[model samples]
Target: MAGWEVRPSDPGRARRRRMLGLLLVLCLPLAFYAGGLWQQYKAPAAVVGALPVTVQDEQLLAEVEELRQRLLVLSSAEKVSQQANEQSRLTIKLLEEQIYKQQQDLASYKGVLAPASRREGLRIRTFELQATDRPDYFRYKILLSRVGKGDTPLEGQLQVAIVGKQGDQDVTHELSALTVDVPEAAPTQSLAFAFKHFQAIPEADRFAELKVPEGFIPREIRVRAEVQGEKPLVRTFKWNKEE
Candidate 1:
């Protein structure tokens, strides 16, 4: 009859095995849920704690701030430039007005001192004839003395004439006329005259021709000066033989 017989399983061992298998099945879903929550809420803390922000990102933020500052500076400069231009225009306008006023004042002052009426101190002192390099032209120089005693300079026009003596008659002609700008209360002044091309009075014959009639010696010349709105000034002077 025979060799082996089958024994019955232990109750505790079987119960323990079933219980372990059931626990594994129930905990698997809970573990999976817990892992998802940790990834959502706590994963960033670990990463942030371990690593620092990148330099590139920091630089980008700095560049944006710098651009903002530059824009503000440019706006301020434009405002300043506009103000300066306005001030410059105003200053130029004021200067022009002042210059015009000064000119008007000068003109008025000149008029008050030299009114056209009294011709007291005007006189001619000397007469001179000289030659220039130009042919057929002579320069006449006249020295005058302002006889006016006023403090202001006198302004007047001098009328001159050249007289020639024929055998028995006197021929008078106008040589050259000039305006004398005598200063106020000045003692002596000079006047010059340039005769148009005249072959009769060339450089070689610098002397002016004077003809004395039968009774005259051609000794002296007469001069008269007239100021606007004033009487004329008259005088006579002898011509120097050596001149």
Candidate 2:
């Protein structure tokens, strides 16, 4: 009942594998088609020119043939150059896709392996605060999971506060003040999320739409997750502009 109840499936990994499989399926036929085109022009121009011609048009035909030969050579060079460029593009694209997938794999693996087994109950994983592109806006993410049977859901109310400096002294502000408190609106602001195994706080609801005073600078973020009949789990993260 303890340890992993079900092996966590990486949906992103499955999608990447499917894409790579489709790419391989697509590339094989393309390669074969290119090879077939390359093989069709095997015979030399000298053989074609040596064929017997009518007596009156022989001199004119020879001049025409020379021009034809030059044009054919130029066309062949251009065709090969075009094909090489296309192949180069495909190769670059494949490499870039591969590198991206590898990076995703590394991140997923770390997420699974980095934390040691707790054997029972709930635990919070990574918590990150990211500054958004919009002025005075920031985003935060928290991942929660339970170890053991996972038959009973972990019920908890997650509360977050921004601890900043109003002047010389520190001040704390609840995250709910910046967002709507409702099931229909900003659920992540002050919602109780329940999960048997894990849950991610929703993306749209993850950001704190702060209205910090002009002079007050944010210094720390404190998150308190209180489970039923259990002591509140608290995590304090230092905030700074540079990071």
Candidate 3:
């Protein structure tokens, strides 16, 4: 039989191979752990830098809110100031109207009392038509003044007529015919007047409110004073509406 040749194994080489395999396994775990730590570190740097921007944004929002509140307050103040100015204007207008009325009254009284302004016979001092709240109604005022004639009171029958257009036709209406209902003490057919110096139409009431017929446009007013034992005094005035 032929003798077989024996091959010898190297223990050092086997040991070195085993040690290299163990090192590779350990290094894989260490590399994974280091990569996770690096990602965490890089992300935090960017996050930390953004903190200043967030603080600035909060400060800007606060400033905007403060400005909005200031604007609102200013707007409220301006509105109040406008209202006050409007009220002041209205007050001034009312005062001016009062002053004008007082001046007119003073002039009227002076005309009646002054000797140089005296007239001998019955005089139609003033005749005015004022608009009432109703569109088809009016308030009228007539003042009669007398001077130097007599201590005896003058008596008269006052007749008033209005000439106007009624639907393309000329129409005339007597004051008594258009007169509204009145108390028994008041005159019905015609206004009666008896006064020493001055007399106002509708002696009891300051003015009389007359209803104008529909479709009638007034143009002129005629007044006749039929005084006892004296010639009648007739006066005509163009119709003009006062305020």
Candidate 4:
């Protein structure tokens, strides 16, 4: 039996034992590191509740707090940049709309001031009243031009008067009176112009907004202008019904 015990060792069994020993040696450090991590950061119960913390856990918690602060700073910067970009887009859109409106106004004035627009001396070229999207509101554009006069400017003050039915009776209201929807109104109205060939009443001088009375139908508009050396030029135009 002693001789049998000393028989040749199995090569595979020896190799397996050596490998197992080496594996344990290699796994000892990893196991210690995992235990340290669990004790410091992870709850012993493995459920989301209060943990029994140690001094080392405070350091891990501090590291987590630092990571949270860094994340907040990065996220705040991204949010501000996005908001700034949105504001820039809105500003650009508004400017584009303004430019488009100015261009249209310029083209309209150019047509009215052309050389052919002068059919007679000190005449009304166009009187257009446009209703806006708001109820009881209106906007008007009046073009006054003098023709056959060579290079001499026409200096005068123009006045606009509206004729419509306020109620059962016919009524007349000036530009300033129509600023309010009421019938009894005091006026502060003057549309003055000095141009070589033509004049378009600017926004400040024109009736840019008009508040009409409810159920009132406009019949005619009178544009009366008094030149520097001549008598008043009176022009009565029928309200454009189709518009």
Candidate 5:
């Protein structure tokens, strides 16, 4: 007869086997999902092509630098042009002033040569004072003219005095006292003159300079002309310097 074998069963071991089977069943979906994610991560990515550079773009790049250089050159040229224009304007202004001065001198000469309506005898035409480089030193000029067409030379003595204040007292300084150089033969008090039509003081060949005394404030000038056979003429002029 065939022998029948019977073994004892463990309840805890059977329970453990069933739990493992259930856990395996639960993990099946997670494993499948993880495998799909891995596949996507390993796949190659799509590429994008770069834009092509044209000839016109390259030309523009070269022109940008060239234009910058040209702009700098043009700026310098403009500055130079402006400076030249300013210089030209200044030169024109100076020339105009010279022309005006010349015209005035011409008019004065004409008046002296032909005075249709003027008093006869020696008359003061112009008196001018120009400051020198030295302080309180000046160059003075006096223009004397005789009216009418008389060819006879007029003889006279001119006296100049500076009227101003010295300290608090009013004072007068004669030309003789202020003259820098005094002639040995000429009178020390007055300047003698002999001219037919017109004459300038100290003559054109000589230099006449006056030194103003220290602490002397001048206001106006007093000129006196004592001509032979004529009444003494006295004239006053405000103290001013020639430009």
Candidate 6:
């Protein structure tokens, strides 16, 4: 008897198995590539979470913070400037009010001292003499007493003169343009005047005439005080020459 021959599997079934095997092989490589991409993407998150920040990144953050602080300082400065301006305005207003009050007080004093009799009893006193260098100028200070039998201070020009002998001729210097106002029934107040190069040089033998201008000088240094009208209260002084 001949050996029994086994029938081979179906051609379609064999082909299907071969195709399945090929598909499996191709899918394996694709899966491996996809896994590598996933790992590559996930590595950044893991590393960043675990690693410390770099010095450059920290410096950038610090710079940003510094800029923010500068902006804050600038804003604060602006506010301060605005506040200072407001304060200045208030200060100016206060000063203006004070000036107005002083002016009113001055006016009232003048009204009281406007009489001729008040001028006749005016009290005058010399106070100080300041001599300065370079320009050879002198400043004379005098006090005028405002306390008198009046409601206002006296208002008049104070005539001042300095006379000395230079060589042969007599030298005279006069300052008759100084006008003063004294408050009536008040304490003594000061007045000042400045003279430039008012001196006599006997050695040079030149009589340095420092006389006040003809029209400006008063022959009789007197107060033209206003009573019902106006009158003159004259006073005279003769200066002695100093060697």
Q: Which one is best on lDDT? A: 3
For model 5, where is the 10-residue window of minimal lDDT? Answer: 44-53
For model 6, the stretches where C-alpha displacement exceeds 4 angstroms are 1-59, 78-104, 107-116, 119-243
Q: Which residues of candidate 2, in runs, are more than 4 Å off? A: 1-119, 180-189, 203-211, 240-243
Q: What lDDT score belongs to each candidate, Candidate 1 first?
A: 0.52, 0.66, 0.77, 0.71, 0.76, 0.45
Clash list (residue pairs), candidate 2: none
Rank candidates by lDDT, best first: 3, 5, 4, 2, 1, 6
Top model number, TM-score: 5
Per-residue CA lDDT of model 6 for 1-243, tens digit only, reads 489888886899989999999999999999999999999999999889756667668889999999999999999999999999989976865665455445434543553355755543444322223322323333333333432354443455444554444556555444332222223532232223221211111112111122333333222322122222335333443322111
TM-score of each: 0.36, 0.45, 0.52, 0.47, 0.53, 0.29
**TM-score for model 6?**
0.29
lDDT score at residue 220, model 1, on the 0-100 scale: 47
The local lDDT score (0 to 100) that residue 64 gets in candidate 6 is 100
Task: Please give the TM-score that candidate 5 achieves against the real structure.
Answer: 0.53
Candidate 6, position 7, lDDT: 83
Taking the tens digit of each residue's C-alpha lDDT, what string does model 5 give over 1-243? Answer: 479778998999999999999999989998999999887766533211122345567878899989999999999999999999989976865665455445445544665677567776777766667666578998676777776777789898889888899999999988778878777454357878898877777665334788899999998888899987889998888888421
Regions more than 4 Å wrong, model 1: 1-9, 33-42, 45-59, 118-243
Which has the higher TM-score value, candidate number 1 or candidate number 2? 2
Ranked candidates, highest TM-score first: 5, 3, 4, 2, 1, 6
